[model samples]
Target chain A: MKLLELRGLAASVDEKQILNGIDLTVNAGEVHAIMGPNGSGKSTLSNILGGRDGYTVTEGEIELMGAPVNGMSVEERALTGLFLGFQHPIEIPGVTNMEFLKVAIDSHRISLGEEEMNTRDFMVQVRDISKRLELSTEFLKRFVNVGFSGGEKKRNEILQLMLLQPRLAFLDETDSGLDVDALQVVARGINEFRSDENGVVLVTHYQRLLNYVNVDFVHIMINGTIVKSGDAQLAHEVETHGYTGLGEA
Target chain B: MAVPQPANTLQGDLLKRVLAHEVQETPWLDRSASKSLLNCNGFPFPWKGRWQYSDFRALVEDALSLEGAHNALQSSHDVDVRRFDQPETEAQTMEFGSSDGVGDFPLIDINGVLFRSGTKLSSIAKTGSVKVNDANGSVDRHLMSIEQDAGMTVEETFKTGNRVVLCHVRDNAKLEYELTMPHGEGIGYHCLVVWLAKGSTFELHLASKGAQVRRNDVIVNVLGENATATLSGGWFVDGSDHLDSQVYMNHRVGGSHSEQSFHGVVDDRARSVFSGFIHIDRNASATEAHLTNRNIALSTQARAHAQPELEIYTDDVICSHGATTGHLDDDSLFLLRSRGIGEESARAMLTKGFLRQVVHSEGGTSLLNL
Candidate 1:
């Protein structure tokens, strides 16, 4: 069954149309890569899917698990298993990473009517995930993303994704600012989070991240709409040839 | 001979009468105190007093509509002092006003210390001492002044009308003070007098959550040698509230330290003003002082003004002050939004982050109440 679907979706920002018409669908456990140059409306599409503000969808429809997510808040969508790993993670001063994570966890659990996780269980889980993501325990004690190196912030997002275990994850240039080692760790974190019950859409300008996370399909987006769709090999082709010839096909 | 207009004469008489009345109220007020009050009254309307450029006085006076008295106090009068020790309703003494539907907690004992939260009323002063807790706590025996002096902690909260009165800190003592006032109905007056004794240490924290019209006047006196004072404040002014804070710190002796940092975010039609002065007296050598005020205007109509002034009379002193007023950083906003956080959520997060500094600085469960 299709776990996520976008049909005839159109979106715009500041009264300027960005996503003219978009149509796509993804089943459970599928990894899809969206490749386009800057201003191809790639970021706009990802943002609209996550219900970002300033973008109006003048036409079309979007459904997650057969439920329309357009009216849901960012937190509501997050609780419903949608995750957006930002290209530039926010630096929240004074609030420690551990504190934010616990709040997010408790928020979701409370919504689900589950018992709040005690400190012992929370710390044990945080330690386990930190080891998998190669994050220092000291990092959790510091304020969220404050004064962190570029790679560290990106890895922190993945760590959150792994812990939250969202249903559909949107990776927005998660590969940017990451070294090969960091990229592998990020990919490993994503792989660990991925299961038959979840899916991912990787939005990137480069095909390097695709090398680590095998893509079930690749979609080319341009001028606010999907121009072409193909297998994982298409990512390598675009990486070499760029946007040329692909438009002709 | 041309006669002065009755209106002008009435205004002058009113001002003189106010000064005269206040002087009578505080018989202990020294020569300097009397001169400061007169100077504040003589300060020309909309001219160069501490509130010269701020619309605080007009806004508050119009909102509260003072009739018989410029100051009023509301006391339950039953005076249940025993309730100061427990967290239960049986122990609750006062309820100032509603707070986000989270009813205010009454006076409680923390580690044998007695503290009651600030009420939402103006022109009132209530006093109690930690001296009562001396048996169970190690508090300073000499720190019993109604106003902050050296060697004590003062926690007071209130909602007010148009004026805040005197606060005094004594010489050569260590002091810590906290003020938390969230927005509520009506206008207020906050007249404060802080006196610091020779060789004393002091720290103050002030936070404003949501108040429609708030005007505060503060005077701090730092006397004697080796004295230290630090003041920090934060305000998240939203809705249509207007807030004003004016502080005057006097360095009367040598070898003193005074530091102040005030920050705020004003949204909607809200406005905020912060003016701080650091005065170093003659012969007050080796005096070190710093004052900083920063603000973020969140809306097109939202406005803020920050002024940090330094008056130095000694060549051996090190004093610096700065003020900045602007909106949130656009680049930072873009950075957060790029991460898939909606623009609105991103803005809210950053605003909350800015205020979190004040909350986290306290470094305790006390912030949970905030």
Candidate 2:
């Protein structure tokens, strides 16, 4: 099943074109890696797809599960199986991780016409996921990402990923600023989340994260458009040759 | 403990409750020393000092309309005064006057000017707790001194009108004061003045819910050495409500430490103002003071103003201050929304989190729900 399709997608911020004429498709059970240098607009694609403010889509079509996402709000898109793991997770003091997680899950339940998860069952599920992510149970009681180390913040994002469980997930720089250990944990989460029923759009600055997570396709983006598309080995070529003049039409 | 002074007496005719007119002697209006406050035809410049963000004239106008004397202060005082250790004479009798370090604020004069009744209590207790509840919009004046080596706790819950609390923590004494203003349709104001003597300690907890307009002025003066003071406040306002929380901590001697922290949330078209001031005298050398105010504005139309002022004359003192006023963090909002939470519910949860932080700052349970 096709999870996401972006055909000739173009977007801009402050009236300046950012994602210009981009095209991509992700089917269920496939993981696509998007790599680029600074200002290549890798994050812009994720932001536009995620329905963030300040970005105007100049031209394109975004569909999740064969439905147009043109007029959907951010939360609506999320409920429709669109999730973007932020590169810079926000620090919200006083909002405990447990509360945030429960509320997020309950929101989905309410939207899907399902019963809200009880506290005991929710705690059990969260504790299991947090344990898998090497997060202490006490972490659930603390404010979301407040005073958390860089590694901890990354892992917490993964924890959210596993719990929220979007059908098509866009991991935007999820591996940036993470140590070797934290990167492996994030890779583990991606591997655990990947299935024949879900898809992944991994955007990163380096090929370091691609080493751990297997990729079905690799696309090198530049000037707000993908200039190179190839198999998994293409990542090695870019790592070795650099992106100096890779955009050869 | 022999409680001698009747509850209705004040030094002389000064604290008496009387109407101000040509018919009778208005002994209560003492306009000699605090004339700057009493004789003000209108508030100073509306945009001056603490009144910068909030217009004093508007607050005064609306608060006056809500003023009424119904059910004069539903109060219940539980004074557990142990044996007065010192001879009754040694318990210093301090008179209420302008010389006692209270700044001449116009709001204080407005409170003293219009009030159906004025209740005065001069208590010297070792360990006592007093709880006063005021649903009626009435003004109250209370003077209490924690005798040397004594301790006292005061909890007040009120709505509308004004409340003036004059407290003195004598040498080696402690004072814990807490004030809660529930959500109300009227206005509310509280003016708290605390004086700490040598080796004394003082703590103030102020929690206010939404109101039409509210102002709290808690000033603590550390005159003695080896004293410690802590003040924490929380407030939440929504709709067209407005709140102004002002705090001032002064260190006169050395070897004293003081801290002031305030957290609040403003939603809808509400406006919240916070002003924290810390001053260290020239002789207050080893004095340490810190002030921090954190606020979250939930709506684009909502406004928050935070002013942190510090004046340190001594070289050995350590003073720090920080104030922030911003809308609900976008990053947090995005994270929540991207997880399938609706925009409204996510904002509400984030707002609740912010309020809970403010309430639990003083280690109190979170009784507020959004």
Candidate 3:
């Protein structure tokens, strides 16, 4: 079954149309990349899928596991296993990273009618994931993303992605500000979490991240809609020729 | 022109009620000093510059009625009074006006009168001081623990009426004092005075939860050289409750450091007032003092008033103060909500984080449970 299906998904920000009839689908075990020029509504697509506020769905339908998700709140979409990694992660001073992760995980668990993870097991799981992501234990003690470097913030997003283990993930420009080493770590985290039962969507402007994570399909989005769909070579073509060179693709 | 004394009757009524209590003459509670203070600085009114945002006339009147006064004072085991030296059952008569321009405050005057003639005093067993000497000679890194007066319970209910706490930390000693006030109704006037000796460190944490009306006045005097004092308070006012906190830090000698951090949350129609003053006297050069007060109003009707003031007399001292009042950060709320946490839970978490700074700074998380 398809993990996510967007049928004529149309959305706008502040009464301005951004996503004009965007149709996409991601099946289990598949990875999809959406490359777009600036203001192509890439982030808007991810935010609308994740049910962020202020993004009005003027017309369209969003489905998760073949079930419609209309009018679902941000947290409701998240509890249903949809995660949107922010392009610019917010800094919440005073909310420690550990506390945030615990709450998020518990919220998902409670929504699924499962017992909350005990502290011992939760700490063990976090330790394993932090070690894999090269995040220091001390980082978990600090405020969430407060004073973190650009690369650190992106890695923190991937860290949440790995822990939440959503069925479908929308990484909105997660590779924007990461260094080579941090990018490799983030890609490794994504690869480790990717499985036959889950789907991944990578939204980016460049093909650098594609070098680390292979994709089954690459969609070119221009002016609020996907203009072209191709295999991995399309991403390399855009990187080599730039978006301006691919006219009316 | 004569000052309009609209609260004269209220003051007269309060004085009458205070005099009705059994009188005990002690040097610390000098009736003459109290009367003089009252004469010079009458009851606090909104017209007063410092009290412009806070009016205590109504609270004082409610307290004077004596309705439910006994029930309010009954559940008082939660009030912990910790002292390093032998508990002084016989109150030591200390000069009130020793600090320049401090003893003239209206709250201090009322506290003086209430302490002298009204209310009985109790003493708990003494506890030894916790001392930490820095082998590395670093003034910034010091060891301290919240010390409980030996016989008092860890939790204490706030009793209405007047209460006074006097603490003196010996030279080179480090002490952490924590006071937790549980949920209750009625009015309370509490005064806490602390004296730090040379090279000593004093950390104070006060947390008040759901008090109908509470007024806390804390005065810390850094008398010795190289002494440091930190005062942190968190107040959660809800319903129709009101909380007013006044903190005064006096840097008497050079090389002393002091800081005050206060965080308050006002919900429903509740109101919170915070006034912090740091006075750096002359010859107190090299003194570093800072005060910050931040408050969050949760409801449309909730109100918070903060005044962080600094009076520096010396040129070679560093002193600054800041006060801010606003609702919760929308970005923070969205961040939490995006992580699968519901809106209400996310709000509660943010609010807890707001107050966690004060509690965690002084290692007083136990107060959160209360």
Candidate 4:
């Protein structure tokens, strides 16, 4: 069954249309890479999928696990097993990373009718995740992304994805500012999030990321709509010749 | 949470003024307090001036009444001493309004510091005199002694009324005390005085809620060549309770250092006021002083007012003061909520963090038990 299904999903902000008619679907356990030029509505699609504010869904429907998610809020969508790693995550001052994580974990735990983790157990779990992400313990004490570098924030977002274990993850430009080493680490983290019950949609402007991580399907987005779709080799083809070769596909 | 008791409702200034007199037997102290009462005539209703933003007058007029001031005096002197944080068994203590000797701490006097509390209304008559003004351009001062290691806690419930007064802490002595006004009655005061010796220190921790509390604390540190003093407090008021703390600190001698910090969180219709002033003398060279006042307004009706002033007479002295009053940051709140924390829980977390800054600085971590 499709983990997320979007049909004719048109969106607008302040009377300006960002996304036209768009149709997409991802079944469980599939990795999809979306490549598009800047302002080609790549981030807009991710935000709309995440139910972020300031966007009016003028038309179409988005279903997550068979439930319509078009009217849900960003937080509501998060609780519904949908996670989006932003291109530029917001920096929150005075909020420690650990405190933020505990609240998120406990929230999901309560909804699942499970016992909430105490401070000691929560710290242990956070440490384990941090170790896996190569995140230092001191980073957990600082404010969330307050003074973090671009790569550090991207890694932190993946760290959150690993902890939340969302059913569907939307990574928006996660490799924009990463070096080769950081890109490999981020891909490794994503590989960890890949499970039979979950799916990932990596939104990027270039094909450099596909070098480190494998992509099952490569969809080229133009004018807010997926204009072409092909297997993994398509990414390599698009990398060399750009979208010029897929003309009128 | 609700207040445990009902508020008192007495009318006019005369009735409340007379009630203050009858509660204390110290005729001298009675006379000293009455002079300040004259200023109450033109006292700006908490809503009448720049201070008019919060409806403090309505709170005083509606939520306050003539409570048993004498009962408050009785409780102050009789609180169980063993329950105190730092108990002193041997110290020269003077008996005044504090019946239980709440500030009785050991080694304070031997350290060349004197602390006194629970002095009777009569004992203040023999001490020296102090002249100070209330908010309404009225000057009121009193005479009191330096009772070493004598202290008390004022645990009064104000149903509809409050008690206002002036205090004097003499030089070269130390005093540490706690003022806990939880619920029921409201306590209002015009001015408080602290006359520090050349090398004395004073520490005070105040926590109260469920009433309208307004107190003015004035400290005049007579720091002899190498003297120091520290002042710190935390005010956590919730429900319909209102608490105000006004402080004035003066560094009169050179080579003296002073630090003051107070934090408040006002919830519901509760209001907290923090007005502070720091003065550095001309000859007080190499003097270091810092003052900070922070408040969090939790509800729309919840109010906070802060005015931090710094007066430096010597160019070499380092003195700084900052004041901030606002609700918790929405971004911080959103960050917590995104993690699944409810709005209420997020507010509590921030409030606790705000208060923890002061508690940690006060050198007494065990007091919070958190």
On residues A222-248, what C-alpha lDDT tens digit does candidate 1 reach at each position?
Answer: 888889999999998898889877655
Residues B1-370, candidate 1: write the lDDT tens digits: 9876664455455444433433232232122332333334342343345546555335422422332222122232211222212224521222211111111101001100111212221111233222111111111001124322324444545454333322344454455556656565765545445566766666777777555567665667786688778888788776788777878888988888888877778888888888898889998999889888878888999888787888888799888899898877664555444333455755776676666665533422143233
lDDT of 3 by residue, A20-122 (tens): 8889999999999999999999999987887777888898898987888887787888888888888999988768999999999999999989999899999
Rank the candidate models, highest DockQ first.
Answer: 2, 3, 4, 1
Q: TM-score of chain A for each candidate?
A: 0.97, 0.98, 0.98, 0.96
Interface RMSD for all numbered candidates = 5.2, 1.0, 1.3, 3.4
Relative to the real complex, the DockQ score for model 3 comes to: 0.65
Task: Report the alpha-carbon TM-score of model 3 versus the true structure.
Answer: 0.82
Which scores greater on TM-score, model 2 or model 4? 2
Candidate 3: segments with Cα more than 4 A from true spot: A147-149, B1-5, B9-30, B58-101, B116-159, B168-175, B195-198, B252-254, B282-285, B361-364
User: Where is model 1 more than 4 Å wrong at Cα?
Assistant: A113-115, B1-8, B18-49, B52-202, B208-215, B218-229, B236-243, B249-259, B265-272, B277-352, B360-368
> Model 4 over residues A200-248: C-alpha lDDT tens digits?
9999988888887788898998877888888889888888888874647
Among the numbered candidates, top lDDT falls to 2
Worst 10 residues of 1 chain B by lDDT: B103-112
B105, model 2: CA deviation in Å?
A: 3.6
Per-chain TM-score of chain A in candidate 4 equals: 0.96
Candidate 2: what lDDT? Answer: 0.77
The TM-score that candidate 4 achieves is 0.66
Q: Model 4, A86: alpha-carbon shift in Å? A: 3.9
**Docking category of candidate 4:** acceptable
Per-residue lDDT of B1-370 in model 4, one digit per residue for the tens? 9555322222235335433433232222212222233223323333443243344444334212332212223322322222111224323221222212111111111111111112222111222222111112111112233443333222222222322332334444444434443444534442234555555556655444435544433444444655565666666667766665666677778888888888777888887777787888888889888988888888899888788888888888888899898888765555455444566777777666667556542223333321
